[model samples]
Structures are given as C-alpha cells and as structure tokens.
Target: MSSSSLTVQGLAKRYGEFVALAPTSLDVPAGEFLTLLGPSGSGKTTLLSLIAGLASPDEGAVRIGGADVTYRPPYERDLGMVFQNYALFPHMTIEDNIAFPLKMRKVGTAEAKARAAEALEMVRLPHVAKRFPRELSGGQQQRIALARCLVYRPSIILMDEPLGALDKKLREQMQLEIKRIHRELATTIIYVTHDQEEAMTMSDRICLMNAGQIEQLGAPGDLYFRPRTVFVADFLGESNLLPARVTAATGDTLDITLAGDAGTAQAIASGAVLAAGAQVTVMVRPQNVVVRSAVEGSGKLKGKLADVMVTGSLTKLYLDALAPGLPQLVAAYPTRSLSDEHRIGDLLELDWQAADAVAIADAKGH
Candidate 1:
C-alpha cells in the first residue's frame, strides 16, 4: 500500500459545554507509526475519531497526503479504522470478512478474493481463510480484523486499542505482529492506546494527551528520560517526585534544597530558567534512585526502610523518609542486587546524579 502524510492543524472538539479536545496540531511523515497515548477521557480517542472522520470537529482541519478531508465523510476519507473489539461478521468465513471491504468498493469478486489472501499472508495467517470467526482464537480474530483493514489498500490506517481485549501474552504478541505489518506495508498509522509500554514498543513518536490537551510529544526514550512536565514524568512511568527549593541556577545545572530536612540535590534544568529560591520538583525514576548505607558516598538522604516487595526480577523498597516531613519515596533494584544488610528498618541514603534527575515546575500530585 502507498503511504501518506497526515497533518492536523488547529484540530479540536466539543460536546455542548464540555471540551472534548483542545486545539492541537501534529505532522506525521509518510510511513511513520505514531501513537496517541493517554488515560481514559484524555481525548486521545476523540482526536483519533476526528482524524478518521467518525466525528466532526468543532474547529480545525485534517489533511491526508495533502488533500483536505476535514469536511469529508468517513468512507471518502480513504482511511481504515480498527476498534478495540474485533468487529467481524460471525456467519461469514474469515476470507469473506477480509474481502468485504474490497467488495464494498465494487472490486471484482476474483480479484477481491486474491487480495484477501495477500492481506492474510501479510499478517502471517494465510491458512485460516475458510474458518468462521467463532472457530478461531481471539488473537486470530484480531488478525482477521487487521487483514480486513489491509485488504482495502488505504494509505492511512487508524487503530483504536486494537489489542486491548486480549490477554497479556496475546496482546504482546499482537503488538509485535502490528509492528511487523507496519514494516512490510509502510503505511502511515495512527494508533490509540492507554498502555505506555505498548506505545513505547510500537510507535515512532508518542503524543501523550491529558485533559483534552497534548501534554508531551516526542520519541519514547526522550519522553521517558527527559520529561517536559511533572505529569509527563509521573504518568509515563514510576517516579519519585520531591519538592525542592532552588538555591542556585548556574549554566545547565540547578542546585536545590530538598523539602523538609532532606539535603541538597542537583538536576538538569528544563529550559524554564528557574530563578534562585524558586520552588521546583525533582523527578528521579525508581531505577535511578540509588540506595546507599553507612558506607556511602554523597548520599545525604536518611530514611528507614518501610517495606520491601519482591516480584520477578526486581525488588522495590519503600522508605519512610527520616528527613522530617518529606514525602515517602521508593527505589528499585534487581533482586539479585539485594543483600542481607539491606533489610527493613535499616537506615538508608538516597543518591543520584544531577544528570540523571529531572527538574520541572512543581506539581502537587500526578
């Protein structure tokens, strides 16, 4: 299938007095895989619906491959959309389900059947053509749904949580299948999901939404490692956010005093140009938080172990900060890294480098 570039300019939506999506603009290069990621009611699906012409926007326009399709109908937009549920015909065979799209556009029967087989082969499921939807597993049914979408040869495909209904293993397996299909077809794809790990695995870029607005948009690693905001930091992964008073702002570093009796911390500034004595938040990922004991170097933070939970390969340690009223924080290490000396009730110090920690505007909570 030929790929297409997608552009959304000033796109927005509203339901009576409530704003469903704020004005947003984005550009997706041809053949790129972009994911819209957020929690429920975050407008990711609403934006996808608007782009697919399922719902009309209150403002703004959408263009596919340089053609303005904002006012066009869903079918005229030439885009294929897959939903959470595999919407397949129960009575029809899998081959017919895949060919239905081609038949809708009035392709000849023989050619439609041939294209359906090709689509199935693209998904690595060429043998299930004659089986009914009930005869196949959930993952197989989802693959048939995708084959149905691919049979139409649309330049753009929009998927809204296509694998959300499957079990964990199946979902992960489908994620890899989707990525492979993208590689082979090279079509412009816009995917919507609330799963952060799924987005990270399949997307070329992630547009993280929040409260009808785009919070942060970037590659997966950039968004995770260098979050632009506190919400971006806490929402994408586990984080320990500490309120700190900025004592010195020099060059690329911001020296800050931790809240309560916690000592100083240094973190990289995020272009906000924090002023002296300004209040900011320190964001350190759990893996980045170093737990040190009496044999430590530059730890300064003193806390008692409140709990330890071991699951699989990782062990999580929750600390009750002895640094006055500072918030309780957590650190994680590989289970094999934990020693007998690191027990509950043991005093520990938290340490991390300025380069590893992030500084963002203060927020009360996620």
Candidate 2:
C-alpha cells in the first residue's frame, strides 16, 4: 500500500550494434503523472520496458522509493502495467479478472473479491463486476483492465497506450476518466504513448524522447512556447520555420533578416545565445501568425494565399513564399473570423510579435 516515488540513473538499452536508448536519468516524484512521449521507434517504449523490467538495459539503474530495483523482476518491482490490449481473461468474470493479481499472491477469496469490487467502483464500473469481458464495450473493458491493475494497489502503474484501441471519442472520454482517477488516487503513474495530445491532456510533465535521447522535457506549454531546438518546436506541433540571419543580438532580442525576404524580424532570443552574423531559425507557431496588410513597426512577411483548410474551430491559411527549398507557410485563424471574402491567390501580409517567436540555432541535418 506504499505509494513511492520512482527514479532512474543512466538507464539505457541496446540491441546488437545499435543503441535503442542512450544513458538517461529521470526522476518522478510520488503522485506525479509523468508521460513518455515520442514518435514510433523513438525509445519511449524501450525506456518504459526498462523501468518495468520487461527488458534489461545495457547500463543503468532503476530505483523506487530510493531503493535499487534495476535487476528486479517485473512482478517483484511492485508495479502494475496496463497494455494497449485489454489483456483481460475472456473466460473469467470481470470480478475474477480484477482479482487475479491478488489471487496470485495467495489472498483470501473474500478479501480479493472485496478489493475487486472496490477497484471497479473506483473506475465507476461497479455494476459491471460480474460481466464477461466480451460482453462489455471497449472502453468498459479498458476500465476493467485499469481496475485490475489498481486492485493490487501497486506503487506505480505503467500504461502503454491503454486507449490506442479506442476510437477518438472513446479515447478522449477515457483520457478524462484516467485523469480523474489519477486525481483521486494520487498514485505515481508513468504512461507511454505516441500521441502528443494525450500526453498534453493527462501528464503533469512530459518527457519527449527521440533517437535514443531526450529531446525536450517540461510542462506542455513550456515545450510548446519556448522550444530550445528546431526539432522540438516542429515535433510538438505545427510550425512555420523560416530561415533567418542574426543581423544584431541584444540581451532580449535577436534582429534577423529572413531568407528570400528583405524585411528584418526580431524574435525572443534569450534562451539560446547567438552572435551577430550567425544563422538562426525563426520558430513561429501557425496560430501565432496574423494575416493582414502592411503595418509600420511590424515584421511583414509577404506571401500569396495558397489554400485554406478548416478543421473544427480553426481555419488554416496556407501561403506560398515561392522560395527555393522552403515549404509553404501556414497561419491559423479562428473559424469564425474566416469569411467568404477570403480567397486564394490573394497577396497577404503575415506578421507576428517578436515575443511570440523563438530563435533557435539552425539545426543541421534536419
């Protein structure tokens, strides 16, 4: 029943000649919901498996409550895991399925059943305790699986895309459920998913991994607003990266001239120090850009409107700068603001406040 913090020092893995995970160290305070986020083959799951003892690491140590657990077996590590697959027992009733972990440890039938009912109630599915897995909906089955994991009250829970099998609506619904349960239980949870939105919606902090290393790790807004690298900015969300040269550098601003454009732009550059004449990448989110006419004292980027894309509450304006090797830029506007008057081929001016953009050192080989 002890809810303990989890830690890792130099945890890494490899297969043959390739390194799947380089040496990495992280700490998850007790009761924190930490998410491992990355694209496929980015070592997020490999790190999770290492923490779960599902795979051995080439070099590293895992600690729980400040005690060494690197070499411990999964079951003995006091961790419960919920996989993308429901992994529920088809032949057993939901109650038995939830009670399996307790039963394995020689718990009495009465105690296991009581705890199983409690776990079901915790997941808001007490009524489905006696139903078979095949008889429940996918969401309900996943909830049951969650309940099964909680029955043992492990110190930490490792969830690997538990909602990956659900449709969008169901996945979103379950995200709220998982968030509510974490709030209620306050247990340390380490979740692994390729879905960035899910990580943003549910995690207290996000650890974004890539190429066997941590790309950028912080609160969702921190990573999105002030990315330290171009890769981090582009990966977190939609970005309109423009090449620029640092014409002048100050303590708070980096004045740069955009490639293929004559106007100079200023952006926040305190995060990464750059000297004058150094090349930088202007990191601007599509939503932060504004389409308008030429305005004094504003950095104007002129482009022709290429197309419009409407998704839910936002309208995206794709603009072509006609620059060689550069892709079309995008600016997102509120759906309500996009009227019939807007059309393609219109010469429009795009501008963004210097505070809204970050200047990252030009990443090579991107």
Candidate 3:
C-alpha cells in the first residue's frame, strides 16, 4: 500500500464557549505511526476528526501530502477510518464487507474479489472470508474491519480507538497485530487513544494533548524520561513531583532544596534558566529512587516506611512525609531484590543520582 505525509497547520475547532481544540500545528512524516494520546476531552479525538474531515475546523488547515484538504469532506480526503464499534455489514459475507469499498469505487468485480482476498490475508484471516460478521468473534470482526480499511489503500488511515471494545488481552493482541501490519504496508497511520500503554507500545511518536492543546510531542522514551512539563511527566507515567527551590545553577545542572526539609537534590536543569530562589518541581521516577537504612547525614531524604507491596515483578515501598510536611513518596525495586529485613515504620533514606532527576518549571499545573 502507498502512503503519504500529513500536516496540520494551526488546525483548531470549537463548540460554543468550549474550545474543543486549540489552534494546533502538527506534522506527521510519511509512513509514521503517530498516536494522539490524552485523557477524555483533551482534543485528541477532535484533532483526529479535523484531520479526517469529519469536522470542519474553525480556523487553520489540514494538508495531506502537501495538498490542502481542510474544507474537503471525509470521503474526498483519501483517508480510511476504523472506528471502535467494528462497522461491518451483518448481512454481507466477510469478503463482501472487505470488498464493499472497492465496489463503491466501481472497481471490476474480479479485481475487488482479488483485493479482498489479499486484504484478508494481510490481516491473517484469509480462512474467515466466507463467514458472516455475526459468526466471528469481536477480535475477528475488528480484524475484518481493518481488512476492509486496508483493501481501499487510502493515502492515510485513521483509527479512533479501534481496540476500545476489545478485552484487555484482545486489545493487547491487536496492538501488536496493527504494528505488524503498519510495518508490512508502510501506511501512514494517525491513531487516537486514551490508553497510555497502548500509545507507548504502538506509536513512533506520541502527541500528548491536555485541555484542548498539545502538551508534548515526542518519542515515548523522551516523554517518559525527560518531560518538558509537569503535566507531561505526571500524565505519561508515575512521577515523583517534589516541590523544591533552586539553590544554585551550574551549567545544565541545578542544585535544589526539596520542600519540607526533605533534603537537597541535584537535577538536570534541561536548559531552563533559573535564579537562586526560583520555585520548581523535581521529577523523579520511582524506579530511580534507592532506599536504604537512614544514615547520620542530611544528604539524603529521610522518611518513615509506611507500606511494602509486591506486584509480581516489582515491590513498591511507600513512605510517609519525607519530612513533616512533604507528600508521600514511593520507591520500587525488583521483587527478587527486596530485602525482608525492612519493616513498616522503619526510618529510611531515599536517594537517586542527579542524572535520574529533572527540575521543571512550576507552571501549567492545571
């Protein structure tokens, strides 16, 4: 299948006083698997709808392969959309459902049948072509829906939570299947999902949306490891957002004092300029934190261990008040490495390397 690049220049939408989508600009390279990820009502679906021409934008434009299509209807945009509820024809055989698109385009009967067969093969469901939609399971039906979309060979394919209706196991199974198909066909895909793990597993890049605007756009690792905003850090994964004050700035590193006497920690400045007394939040992942028996020095954060829970592969340790006024903190270790000597109410010290922490500006808390 052929693919083309997609670009959205200042695209936006609205409903009365509620801004469904803020003026947003995004460029998706050709053959890129891009996922629009966010919580509900974060403009991910709105953005996808605008790109698919399902909704007209209040301003800006949508371009496919550099061609203007902002005002075009959904069908004229050369895009295929797969929805959550596998929209298949119950009365039609699976082959006919896959071939229906080609029929509408007036392809010859022979060619439509050939393409339908080939599409079913692509989705690994060649044996089920003769079966009706009702005879197939949900996962099987969703595969048929995907086959129908692929048979058309549209320039771009948009998936709006196509796996939302599937069970967790089936959804995960389909995620891998979709990634394989994407690799095989090299089709440019713009997928929308509210599932964080789904976005992380499937996309070449993730465009994280919040409050009708794009919060962060980057590879999953970048967004997870070095987020530019607190919201990005908090939304993408579990993060320890410790309020702190910048004590000093030295090149790309910042020495900060944690609030509530939780001790000082050095963190990457991330190119942001801050003075000696600027308020910021230090973001640290739980896996990065190392907990040990409390020591005599004030170099590490001191807390009382509150709980220890094991979650198969990892053991999570919860601490109460790094100091008298700090919020709770959490640290995780491999379940196999957890020490049995540590007990609840034990005094503990938490520390992490400076490189594992990042200090972000205290803005955009909403």
Candidate 4:
C-alpha cells in the first residue's frame, strides 16, 4: 500500500464563543505514525474530525500528498477510519465485511476476495473469515474491522480510541498487533486518544493538545524527559515538581533554591534562559530520585517515609517532604535493589543527579 504525506496549515476551529482548536500547523511525513493525544476537550478529536473531513475547519488548509484537500469530502480523502465500537456488520461474514469496502470501490470479485484474505492474514485473523461478527470476540472483531479498513488500502488511516473498549490485556495485545501491521505496510496513520501510555507505545511522534491548542509535539522520550511546559510534565507521566528560585546559571546547569528550607540544588536547564531571581519549577522523575538513609552531601531533601509499596519488580516509596509547603515526593526503585530498610515513619534522604532533573520556568505553571 502506498502512503501519503499529510499537511495541515493554519487549521482553526471554533464553536461560537468557544475555540475547538487554535491555529495549528503540522507536517506528517508519509508512513509516519503520529498520535493526537490529550485529555477530554483538548481538541484531539476535533483535530481528527477536521482531518477526516467529518467537520470543516473555520480556517486553514488540509493537504494530502501535497494535493489541496481542504474542501474535499471524507470519501474523496482516501482515508480509512477505525472507531472504538468496531463498526462491522453483524450479519455479514468476516470475509465479506472485510471485502465490503472493495465492493464499493468496484474491485473484481476474485481480486477483492484475495485482498480480503490477505488483509485478514495481516491482522492474524484469517481463520475466522467465515464467522459472523457476533461469533468473534471483541479483540477478533476489532482485528476484522482493521482488516476491512486495510482491504481497500487507503493512503491514510485514522483510528479514534480503537482499543478503548477492550480490557487492559486485550488492549495491549491489540496495540502490538496494530503496530505490527503498521510496520509491515508503512502506512500513514493519525491516531487520536486520551491515553498517554497508548500514544507513547504506538506513535513515532506525539502531538499533545490542551485547552484547544497544541501544548507540545515531539517524540515520547523528548516530551517525557524534556518538557517545555509544566502541563506537559504533569500530564505525560508522574513527576516531582519542586518550586524553586533560580540562584545562578552554571554553564548548562542552574543552581536553584527550593521553596522553604528544602536547600539548594543544581539542575540541567536544557537551554531555558532565566535570570538569577527567576522563579522556576524543578521537575524530577520518580524513577530518577535516589532514596537512601543518607546522601553524602548537602542539598538533600529530607522527608518522612509516608508509605511503601512493593509491586512485583518495582517498589514505590512515598515521602512527606520535611520542607514547609512542599508536596509529598514519590520515588520508585527496582524491588531487588531495596532491602527491609524502607518503612513507614522512617526519615529518609532524597537526592538525584543534576542531569536527571530539569529546571523549567514557573511563569506558565498550571
């Protein structure tokens, strides 16, 4: 199947007084899997609707493979869409359901049958070709829906919460299956979901939206490790956001004094320019935090161990920061690395490497 590049230039949408999407521009290379991810009302679905031609944009252009498709209808966009409900005909056989799109396109009977079978094989559900949709499990039905979409070989595929209805295990299984098919076909896909983990697992790049606008756009690691805004940091994953005042800039690192008497620490600024007196938030991932009875030097955050949880391979420690006005901090470690020393009510020292922490300006705090 041939893939096509997608470009949205200055796309904007509004519902009377409320803005559904701000002026947004993005370039998706052919075969790149990009996810529109965010919380509800963050414009992810709105963006997907506009791209699929289900809704018209108030302003902007949509181009597929460099061709202007702003005014084109959904049918002419050459895109396939998969929904959470697995929109398959209940009465039709799985093979006939997969071939339905080809029938509409007036493909030859033998060719459609062969392509339908091939699509079923791609999704690893060829054995159920003769079964009705009701006879298959939820996961198998979803695979059949995907096969139906692929039988016609649309240039782009848009999936909106395709696995939202499945259980955790089944959802994970479907994620891998869809990724496998994507890898095999190299088709351009624009997926929309509120699940950060799902986006991280499946997307080549993620476009995070918030408050009807794009908050960040980058690889999962880039958004997780080096977020440009506090919302991105807090929304993407668990983070320890410490309020601090910048004390000085030391090369690429910045010396910051934590709020209250939490002492001072150095953090990599990651190119954020700030003055000495600038208020900022230092973000540290829980996995990067080191918990020990004693940290060698000063600048350690002392806290009482509020709780400890051992979950299979990982042990989580919750600590109440000794500093006034500071929120509780959480630290995660490998279960094998911890002994019986961690207990509730015990005072522990928390520390992390300067490189593992990021100092972000607090002006845009959420």
Task: Please name the candidate that would achieve the greatest TM-score relative to the true structure.
Answer: 4
- Pairs of residues clashing in candidate 1: none
**TM-score comparison, 1 vs 3, better candidate:** 3
lDDT, candidate 1, at 229 = 88
Better of 2 and 3 by lDDT: 3
The digit string of per-residue lDDT tens for model 4 on 63-129 reads 9999999989999999999999898998899999999999999999999999999998899877998
Q: How far is candidate 2 from the true structure (C-alpha RMSD, Å)?
A: 2.0
Query: Which runs of model 3 end up more than 4 angstroms from their true locations?
Result: 337-339, 364-366
lDDT of 2 by residue, 79-154 (tens): 9999999998899999999999999999999999999999999999999877899999999999999999999999
Candidate 1 lDDT (Cα, 0 to 1): 0.89
Which pairs of residues clash in candidate 4, taking residues 3 or more apart in a chain or in different chains?
A: none
TM-score per candidate, chains pooled:
0.96, 0.95, 0.96, 0.97
TM-score of 1: 0.96
**Structure candidate 3, residue pairs in collision:** none
Better of 2 and 4 by lDDT: 4
RMSD after Cα superposition, model 1:
2.1
Off by over 4 Å in 4: 294-297, 337-339, 364-366
Q: What root-mean-square deviation over C-alphas does model 3 reach?
A: 1.7
Q: What is the lDDT of residue 163 in candidate 4?
A: 94
Clashes of each: 0, 0, 0, 0
Better of 1 and 4 by TM-score: 4
What C-alpha lDDT do the candidate models reach, one value each?
A: 0.89, 0.87, 0.90, 0.91
